[model samples]
Target: MTPSSALKAESPSALETISRNPRIRIRRSGPPAEDAKCVVYWMQRAERAVDNPALDVAIDVANELDLPIVVFFSAISNFPSANLRHYVFLNQGLRDIEADLAERGISFIVRRPPKNSLEALLTELRAAMVIGDENPCREPERWRSVLAHRLKIPYWTVDADVLVPSGLFPKHYFALHIFRPKLYAHFPTYLVKPENPKPVRQWQRPPNFESFDVKEDLTEGWKHLDRTVQPVDYLTGGTHAALKRLKDFVANDLAHYQDRRNHPEKAGTSHLSPYLHFGHIGPLTIALAVDQALKQKVITKEAYDAFIGEVIGWRELAVNFVKYVPAYDSIDCAEPWAQKTLREHARDKRDPVYTLEQLEKAETYDELWNASQMQMVKFGWMHNYMRMYWAKKILEWSQSPAIAFENAVYLNDRYELDGRDPNGYAGIAWAIAGVHDRPWFDRPIFGTIRYMSAASTGKKFNSKLYIRNVMENEPPPLLT
Candidate 1:
């Protein structure tokens, strides 16, 4: 039979393989007859066994090769620029992931790295083929590139985070308007129903390795590591909680999402950004659920489209931006006009210079800004709409644009569970540096990044009520 004919004749039930780079390959390797041909070195994303493209592809490849699949997660002592808050959230998520994998008949191995990158751990695992969830961010991408080069075996990077693969589009997107049409056109192709994992009848014993409890090791191991950052205690992490949150949102809040999402006090939003950022829930699952809701006529197309725009259009654009522009995290990725404008406005005078400590402690003069900061500090997440106003205030209050950008990133990464995401970086850049944003009415420090003010927020919604509710009810350190 011809290769094309064989391909056509194959069962339609087979798992679909999606690759960004055509040169990437997945092959059977390592010990013979052991039934562990494809070993997935799971990194970046966590939790759900369902709706995960990487885990699904790995399982399918293992089944085809008649081998069992083993999933490995490497925990390094020191992640570059990561603070105590980042570790706390990630560790909590991982703890939940370990339990979930065990229930699914998959072996979960946690290997401790000597340092941040998993170079030493991957080398020690001798994995036949390492598979990781694609992340356009600096650390994960750097780690993947190092692994692909250093590992003797083949490596696969799967786009499980975004609805559309980052590689499907060109390296950088011009703007949200430009990227929106492209995402809408490809939604059908990437929004297929998620494949469920068929339970494996035979279990493959994992090779003996050192067990590193993320919580205990993180606390104990901090002293031994090169870095001196503290561990955070923000929001609870892990797949179980993420799934629970999704179910809760759908049952309790999704109906009111259209009306109350913009209000900070209502808890009407999904609050899934952190989970999405960490890969606890796949974008496909969210899309499917939202699509189903739309079909049921539970949500208006306008509302559904708005939500989808965020997940697909805006989110994917950020991923695409980072993927193409290597210096996306830096100021160089900003448009030339924006760069010049920001530079000119960098030294502009401020109403009051708020130190990083003041911002971090939510001690700003604006009660609304303080409330938002408190939310980020205590809950580790913020409403999407308010996040813009929150970030813009930081730009206005700091001594300079550069200092404002630095403080904004520091606060977000330290407090928000969804911090360290491409979206987070893009949001900060958009607020401070005007990356991907068009020029608007001139402002002091922002210099045409589009200004958002407390008055504007109040005009859009019941600002007084929202502020009162958050300040009174959202719990302390924040309420204080």
Candidate 2:
């Protein structure tokens, strides 16, 4: 913020501050319908009712128009690579929103497509306007654009999930150093904890257009939904679960976060990626909790800074990556230097080129790489350090950079709970195509792209224990 606009940001009154804030972007025509009933909040990316900028804007606008707000969420069976596991977790989150909204005298309705649609629901409810949350990914972005063109009434979206509203930064950031100062400089205006407000008038249930039960399996009858990948048992969805995990991490594991975060054998890192990806928790909520922990002298500043740098820095950087870069999810998104270097050595020969099936079946010769794959398959997550190693090895084993990108994206999206996300895409690009990373020593297949030797990376952590965990959780044939 400039010296002229550096006012002390009010924490409790954060919602009010964001009423006409830069975080909001108008998608459709303005001037809400004069003879309309309720305001519909098209809950998309940010699923939670707490500490959500999107929900805050809906309430603020509804209050101004003297109308009750109705939150409408639609669950489509085929969301790119979404499967049964992803739907289950999403359904759990919808239930959480249902209960949370009830407490605040708001309403939540979950609908499906073909028969049930957002436009139909809005028309039935006679909605004055619509407030939605933002998603930078290609498909979701296209969804919002399509919806905006369809809706006649005022439609706007808030960059709810990200701490820094992605719209503010218009360019693609090459590295953290280039993006760090620019992001932090605007934190004064955007980074405070958002106080989610209740609607001024409670939602009045209409006589028609019934909503699906949140407790039931919404994707049960949809054959298009992939049921091959079953939901894992280790993690539960919902904002309450996210908060519990956050509190536990801050109280117990944060002190050792810096030291043990890279060790795959230990649970030192805050396993909040799934929650963050699903919008079960807001970034500000986690940030404020960590800052308070630091203030209480529970964790050292070094640990605090390190955690923030990884969780906050790298995350928003990925968001910026997806927001600006058109081909973010492909090998075409790699830097020019990386592209040239990789192409120069494209035909150098992959000694043990494994097909997608072999990699998916975890039949790789490298024990540690196989363990990382197993971790993602069995646990729906992999250690951050191992993920880097995992992707780098795919590059070493694939025919070309484009092929590596395809295989990595396929496995990552198919297994991990937080798959099909900016972070996952950026991570794969970094490991395989060198998106955010600097060029390193030239190699045969990898070229200037960074290389992670399995032998060297294994020495950094307890690979034996990690492999043991995978073996115990995975089927016996997985290791062979």
Candidate 3:
């Protein structure tokens, strides 16, 4: 068959592979515009060129039509819970993606508008189809829905952030034990790498549109964003940096991860949360690399599986939690028993009750708690083990459970790069209320909810060392 005839015959079913994949979902069902020019990828969550199914789908659809692809990322100035730190980190990663995409002959345009600029861009391009990554977060979800409705072309969203897409499972799973097996069942089918489509036509120039140069605009972008929270120099965001961290973790830390994870003084954890949160790296990329280490015998299978369980298991479970539970960040989503028990102890508080100001400044009696707070404030990151103790104390010291929950979420989302995420929301819920935990022994203020004390934490790790290290070290200068 002639090349033109072959493409015509296969073009009808070219999108079938994407349509049938469990990872991809069609948000709006309409045939591609017959006389359209290019396929558009409205990039949001997944920032990397590598291992992105959404991008792959866009490439495939564009190739079938023998057309070029245009990728647009709307860097809205007022993304919820985002500040200077988050923007700096996210834009740095975006710079990497733009350079990478340029090498592959795809246009990567970014806009920093305060309003919804998607419809304008889509209309300008006269795109045949629109593609985007699936994000369960409230803000992204709303924006995507609005944009999809505005577009007159076919719009599809692909799940590339999580290893097993969040949509595959039931809206909410009670615990890791219940969700882990079900997640594993589909591993054989969905864990493989996504198809990478070769474009038949290459995009020559920047799409005939005016947009912000990510690197240049970032400086002025910060001017319009909240500058209260400054970017930390400790973690530079990008796929290259994220990959380096993952490589080092697999080589040095993965073997001891299961054993030393809880020790605050040790570097046993992979500090890739910021990168993962910003979509600089995908979970599947991290998981596949860990799996390769296991095959090479560089790391034990036990450690490999343990880390994978976390990368896919608990992380995706948290995504599931927020997907099903709209009020996941607040006390409204707490288990019935937990809500009842917490209310019973509402009037039982007796000791010092600190205000949100006091807490944000890390001015507390407990040295360990203060250090943890300081770490989060100064470094834009904190020890995983310290997070549990850090949050419980907020509940123990606040005037009310509701106030405590609000303060915890505010401080967490305000400072951390990984803030406003499912993991953060679910983690806070677990700490303040027994979201996935069973009722513990009744206490004065805690009642049946799980209680974590500084005393108990001290018994597990050298609290003095954690405090001393955090206090003595100087954090890297804020990125400008």
Candidate 4:
């Protein structure tokens, strides 16, 4: 069937699930194989089986072409700044994907490649066409570029990362106010629930198929990986856990979300960041559930609107910003005015300068700052509002703005389960250099970049209560 006719064949729910312009066809190295055994999905970013456009597209195309579907995921053994904690979280989610695919009679293969060797695996499989998920990070971007250049088969990138797809805004948006109307206009179309595409033929292992051990020892066996940072005992990873967290939040805390979201002590916010970061659940799934709650009167319209704005509005805006803005993790990526003003204040003296070690060790003078650091370092997450305060303080205390940006990114990416993501990068940029925000009243160290003081945190919420609650059980620091 032609591409247009394929869309015409799908029901409204299925159309809502996949995208109209999901496929970004890379340069065809050669014509597709006439009798290829299977359609290959190189799962990179969107790691889930459900509510994932790339997987759905692959399945749909496989059904159309009368081929079986095989999902391949390469586990990069040396991911940047990834420690035991990061792997543990990722492995937890991957286990779920493996089991789910098994139940569906789909073949899912995972391998730990040496370096940029995904093409070798594809060659071995003789894939007719390869499909992949979209991610804006430097590493994945490079991988996709290389694969597109080298692969003899056609490569397609399907963006399952954002509600309003990245193609909508070909340029960087200055602010959320500018994108609000654009987002709302597409909400009804994109927010509908998507059904999984069923294959006409299930995959079976070929006689000469190469198979490596899919078993993982998240706790101990991965000696090749860095194991310094251990996983948090509290949070479990996977779609099941993410959905449960969403259910509890909407049932209890969502109605008061607007008023209580900023208060770290309340613990009233939805703790779904890790799940979203891992692609355990897509934004549409959460948004649809929230919409259903609104209709059922489980949550008020005001609460639903506020929650949706954060998930669809602010969250998607961050994704959009990172997608369009090159050098997104660095201070150079800030708006011209922000860059100029920040440079103007570069020489401003920082009192009681702290090294990255001091900051990382949570040995700072301020108890609140130390506690917030402890929360992130120990728990692998931090409340969003406190994160703003945390990054601004790094700028205030570090030797230079450049160094401050580096330190903030390092610690955030190292600890947060949601680290190394666009939200993390954009959030740090907003905190340290004011990327999306407008110029504020000029200050000594902050310049025109927005300033967030620890004292202001006290005025907003009970800082002492938060510190006490989060840091109550931490033991004293070990001597060097």
Top-lDDT candidate index? 2
lDDT of 2 by residue, 75-159 (tens): 8878999888888888898989999999989988888767568898888889988899999999999999999898888677889
| Candidate 4 runs further than 4 Å off | 1-31, 114-117, 207-215, 218-224, 474-480
Q: Show the lowest summed lDDT stretch of 10 residues, model 1.
A: 23-32
Model 2 segments beyond 4 Å from truth?
1-19, 207-209, 474-480
Stronger candidate by lDDT (1 vs 3): 3
Q: What tens digits encode model 1's per-residue C-alpha lDDT throughout 327-392?
A: 666566778888888888877888888999888888877888887787676666777777889888
User: Which 10-residue span in candidate 3 carries the lowest summed lDDT?
Assistant: 1-10
Q: Put down candidate 4 lDDT per residue, 1-480, tens digits, no spaces.
A: 323343344323343333346344333333446678888999888888878888888888777667898998888777777888988888888878887777667888777654225687777777777889888888878878887787767677787877767776767788888888888898877887887867788877877565444455533445677777778867888877887888888788888888878887776778788888889988988998898889999888889888888888888888888878888888878888988888888898899899999999999889889988998888888888889999999999988888899999999999888898888998998998888789999998889888887778877888888788777854221111
Which pairs, if any, clash in model 4? none
Residue 239 shift from truth in candidate 2, angstroms = 0.7
- Per-model clash counts, in order, read 6, 0, 0, 0
Any idea what lDDT model 4 has? 0.79
In terms of TM-score, which candidate is stronger, 1 or 3? 3
lDDT of 3 by residue, 1-480 (tens): 222232243346666554766677777766688887888898899888878888988898788777889998887777887888888888799889998887778888787765338778777777888889988888888977887677778788888788887777866887788889999898887777656666677765544457777777464735657888888888899988999988888888888778878888767888888888888899988988887888899888789888888778889988999889988878888888999999999999548899999999999899889998998998898887889889899999988888888999999999888888888988899889888678999998888988887778898987787788889874421211
The estimated TM-scores of all candidates read 0.84, 0.94, 0.94, 0.91
TM-score between candidate 1 and the true structure: 0.84
